[model samples]
Target chain A: MEALLAISIGVLVAAAVYLMLARHVLRFIFGLVLISNAANLTIFTAGRLTEGMPPLIELGQVAPDPGVANALPQALVLTAIVIGFGLFAFALILMFRAYTTLGTLDSDEMRIAEPREDDA
Target chain B: MSWLLTIPLVLPFLTAVAAFLTRESDWGRKVSVIGNVVFLGAAVLLFSHVYDKGVIAGQMGGWPAPFGITLVADYLSAVMVVITAITALAVSVYALSDINTRKEYLGYHALFNILIGGVTGAFITGDLFNLYVWFEVMLISSFGLLVLGGSKAQIDGGVKYVTINLVSTILFLSGVGLLYGMTGTLNLADLALTVPALENQGLVTVVAMMFMVAFGVKAAVFPLFFWLPASYHTPAFSVSAVFAGLLTKVGVYALIRMFTLVFDQDIGFTHTVLLWVAALTMVTGVLGAAAQNDMRKILSFHIVSQIGYMIMGLALYTPLALVGAVFYLVHHIVVKANLFLIAGVAERIAGSTDLGKIGGMYKTAPFLGILFLIPAFSLAGFPPLSGFWAKYVLVAAALEDQAWIIAGVALLVGLLTIYSMTKIWAEAFWKAHPEGTDPTLATLTAAERRNLLLPIGGMAVLTLIIGFFPQPFVSFAETASMQLLDPSPYIETVLGEAAQ
Candidate 1:
């Protein structure tokens, strides 16, 4: 199962990298989303997968029983997902604005900030 | 005890909320300036406590360290927080005149405060994941501030800045996951103890490289720095000044922390990589500046150049070298931020930041020229200025280590830095204004002049103070470097007696 998950992560990352290499800002955002999900999967897998074991303590117990799933990585991944979602949303809006204001989604054509110099 | 550290982190959020609520009124900018003053006071308290007590660590909500979020400050973190507060205060005041009412209504002050809060949190976090969160906080707010005006150039620049930084953020998050997978611990103090004991030291080195690339982008070193020059000049001058001063330093601070504390197992390989990156960052950055005709763009590229020196000091891994790095960090913040503020002033009065389009400041505004000279010369590493001492220490440390090429690179970069500063001096200040305008400081109102020049003057005084009185600051950085080299005190404070 761990091997399978790792292989999936690799594929996701490879695809993400390919998409991110594109000049279209929207494609780059989609690539960011994919790569970030891959990262989330990594954290989840690294926590050591466990089945039928919730990280919950029973009544009159101070701690969960042995073999309980590690909850820390889940918490970290949840946080990452939320932060990544917010960033993706912002990036989407920024790309839309770039399309409208700059009139093109191609990063190469966006040269108003750093104009191409004639001397160089 | 925890509250002492929490105040600096939380006050900025409180201020941000208040500033947002007041954004419709004239009170927004006023609240920002006042809030920063209070934040500075809290930071000073934190610094004083850390100075007297050595490393200080506190767990949030009274939870034990390694099990809960840890906020810790040694000498290095303490001084960074203090300097961050100083820069925030200066920029907030500068914003009073520089930021327009339309921007104020757009919640500029709120974003600025949140960015400060994020920087402070990054400086103080003792958990790796916590640092990642703070980086996000800083990144998001900076994105807003970068494109706040929604101009075409700002949008173009913001897209690149946002995209590139997002990649770095993902890399950092993955590095955190991988390192945690290897060690089963995320608390920095615990990792410092566990990383060296792992049998898979080879894997640890690979993870170390992951973090190096993650933070390399943040620190704007070598190949990863293109985003900075692309976007920094497009922001509001106040935003650019704060970004110039505090943002990249956060990356440098993170690198220093992770490398010194947790990733020290195989320094030979890692530090050598850093050494080469340092050399190239310096050379390419200064050469990039030479090609720029815009005042802000030249300064922007120079930022990448100066970061090389700091990284050079860290790469050396000697006590004195780290001291040089720390000294350079503090000095660069003040000098670089002040130069940006002065650029803003020149743009305001002279009508352009393009050096070719604007000039004659030396004759009409001698006072402003003097103000610019203090930071400009200091940035070029002139004697008795802050940059000189910083460069001197790093070069001396390199020579002491018998690394002649790196030392030569350091000195050559300093010389090239002088050329760039002189180019600005010659074109923007010394030469006649291309359009034949006088461009006097009298062009601004009394209040505008006071709001603008006060921060520039205050920071100039700070640069001079550090330059003239290097002894105390050097000793402080020495002790900070010592704490970094041996984080045992930091560990003991965070994880308590059993960790020893």
Candidate 2:
């Protein structure tokens, strides 16, 4: 399971990188979404995946049973997922707004902030 | 004591919510200023506590260290928190007149307060995961603050800023995940104990480099600083001042923390990489500044250049060198933030930030010109000023270490920094206004003058205080560096039971 997850993460990162290199702002944001998922999967795989077990302790007991799946990475990945969702959602809206205000999505043309001297 | 530490962290958040609810009216500005005053009091209290007790650690909900969330303040953390509160209070005052009604109604004060809280949390966090969370908090709030005005330049800049920052955040998180996989603990003190015990030191070094790149981008070091000059010059002045003062320094602070605490296993390689990165960052940043004519753009590039000096101290890793780093960090934040604030007033008076278009401030507003010279000259490392001593110690340390090349680079960068400052002094202050009108402070209303000049004057006085009374501040930084160089007190405070 760990091997499969690692390979999938590798492929996902490769695809994400390719997409992120695009000049279009919207496509770049989509690439961010893909890479953020890849990061989540990496945490999931790195924690040493275990199936069919919860990290819960028995009633009134301290510490969970041995050989149970690690719950901490699951929790960390869950939190990363939430934060990434909010950030990328904001990124998408920002790109949309940029598209409207700047009238172009091409990164090269969005140069109002740092305009070419020749243009001036 | 924990509650005292909690006040600095919690009060800004409470302020953020209150400011948000009242952002539609003048009350938002009032609440922000009051919040900053109360937060500054809390920072002073925390600093006093740290000064007396040394390193203080408090676990949330009464749980012991390494098992629960922890807030820890050593000398470095205490000083940084206090300085952050000072900058926030000054910027909040400046924003009262600088940020317009439209932006205030768009919830500017709330986002600004949240950004401050995020910076403080980043400074005091005792867990690696917690630091990343605080970084996210800083990032998201900064995103909101950066584009609050919604102008085309702002959106364009915001897009670049948000995109690059999110990429860096992912890289940071991946490093945290991989480090956790190897050590099985995210608590920093626990990691310090566990990191050396891990058999795969090679993998540990790779993870450390990953962290360096992740923070390098955020820190706006030599090759990775494009987003800063692109975005920083476009934001609101108050936004840029706070961003200038706190944001990148958080990256530097993290680098110092991780290198001193957890990543010391391979300093020969890791710090050597940092040494070269530092030199290049200095050279490239100053050259970048020389090409810029806009007031904020020049200052933004210099931000990248000045970061190299702080990193140089860290890369040297001697006790005295770290003292230089600590001193330079505090000094740079004040001077840089004050420069941006002065730029805002210059723009308001002259009607443009373009150096070619605006001039004659020295004759018309000699008061503003003098205010500009204090920080600008200080930034350029003149004697009896803060930056001179900062550079002096760093160069002295380099010479002590027989690193002549970087010593020369440090001095050379200081020279070039002066050239840029004098360019502003001559063009913005001395020359006749290209439009043939005097740009005087009298043009502004009395209230605007109060809100604007007060903070600028206050920060200038701070630069002078640090400059003239170097003994106490230098001694404080020396103590801070001693604590940084040896992390046992930090580790013991946070993981005493686990380590024992």
Candidate 3:
């Protein structure tokens, strides 16, 4: 399970990197989402996969048996997901504004904001 | 008693939410001012407590470390919190006049509060992953602030800024994952205890490199710094000033913490790389400054250069060097923020930040000129200012280590720094204004003058206080550096016997 998770994370990272290299703004945002998810999975896998484990402790268990899945990584992953969502939303809005103002989604074409020779 | 640590993190966030909810109301600005003042008071209380008690620890959700979020305030964190609070308060006051003129005042204030909250959170949090979360909070809010005005220049700069920082976040996340995977822990103090025991030094080195690259990009180190000057000066003056003052220094703070605690092995390899990077960062950043014609752009480039000095002390890895790094970090934060605020005033009084269009401000606004001069010279490492003592300690550390090349680079960078300051001084203050310029540029109205004086006066007073009686601050930094260099104290305070 751990090996499979690791491989999946590697694949996700590769895909994300490819998307990140694209010239368009939306693709970059998508790339960031993929990268964040890949990171989440990587952390999940690093916690070591366990089989047949519930997410939390059963109510009123005397010993509070240790068989439940690790909750820390899950909590971290949940936070990462929310933060990733925030970044994606912000990036999407920013990209939308850029496209509306510059009339293109290609980052290379948005050169008007670059410092011009006559600026100084 | 330990709960005081939570106030610094919670108050600004609550205020931010309040500011957001009151966006349409006329009381938004007033509420922001009051809330920030309260936050500043909390910071002062936290600082005084930490000063007396040494380090304060709070375990969130009533659970001990390794199970819950922990907030720890050592000397370094406390000092940084004080600095952040003061700068935020000054910026908040300055923004009152500045933001009222803008269309997005509410969002601006909301984002500003969130940024301060995030920075303070980052400083106080003892958990490594929690630190990453706070970093995201800071970065996201900074992104919003950078593009608040939505000008073409802002949007353009914001894109590069967001893209680079997004990449950095991913890298940082990956690093955290790797470190946690290797050590089975994410608490910094726990990691400090466990990291040295790992058999795979190479793996830890890779993780360290990932962190260095992530923070290097954020801190605007030599090769990773291209995005800074491209984006920083494009924002409005307030936005640029705050970003210049706070954002990159957070990255430097992260580097200092990580190197001192988690990655103390192979100092030759890591610290040597840092030394060379410091040298290159300083040289390239100053050259970038020299190449700029605008006042803010020049200052922005110098930010990168001065960051090199702080990292230089980290790379040297001596006690004196560490003390110097801490001292320089505090000095740089204030002086840089002051310089940017002065730039804001200069633009207000002179009608532009472009050196080509601005001149002869000495006659019209001598106070502003004097305000600019103190921090400017301080930043240039002139004697009798805090900047000089910072350099003195750093250079003394390098010489003690017999690292002649690093010491020489430090001296040369100091000279170039002075040269950059002179460039601004001569172009903006000493030269004559051309004929037929806008008559409004020659003078400021009463309100504008007052708005400008508030931040300048606040920063000038700080500069003078730190410059004259630096021993107390230096002693505070020395204690902080000692705590950092020996992580046992931090670990014992955080994880109890498990850390042992």
Q: Which ten residues in a row have the lowest lDDT in candidate 1 chain A?
A: A111-120
Write one digit per residue (lDDT tens) for candidate 1, span B248-304: 999999999999999997999999999999999999999999999999999999999
Give me the candidate number with maximum lDDT: 1
Fnat values, candidates in order? 0.84, 0.73, 0.61
- Please state the error at residue A9 of candidate 2 in Å: 0.4
Encode model 3's per-residue lDDT on B227-252: one tens digit a residue: 89989887767777788888999999
* lDDT at B141, model 3: 93
Q: Relative to the true structure, how large is the alpha-carbon lDDT of every model? A: 0.95, 0.93, 0.86
Candidate 2 ranges with C-alpha deviation above 4 Å = A59-61, B497-500
TM-score of chain A of 1: 0.95
DockQ of each: 0.90, 0.86, 0.70
Error of 2 at B326 (Å): 0.4
Docking level of model 3 = medium
Against the true structure, candidate 3 reaches a TM-score of 0.96
| Tens digit of per-residue lDDT, candidate 2, span B1-500 | 68877889999999999999998888999999999999999999999999998999889888887878899999999999999999999999999999999999989999999999999999999999999999999999999999988998999899999999999999999999999999889999899999999999999999999899989988998788899999998889999999999999999999999999999999999999999999999999999999999899999999999999999999999998999999999999999999999999999999998999999999999999999999999999998999888998999999999999999999999999999999998899999999899999999999999999999999999999999989899999999999988888999988875584
Q: Alpha carbon lDDT of residue B211, candidate 2? A: 94
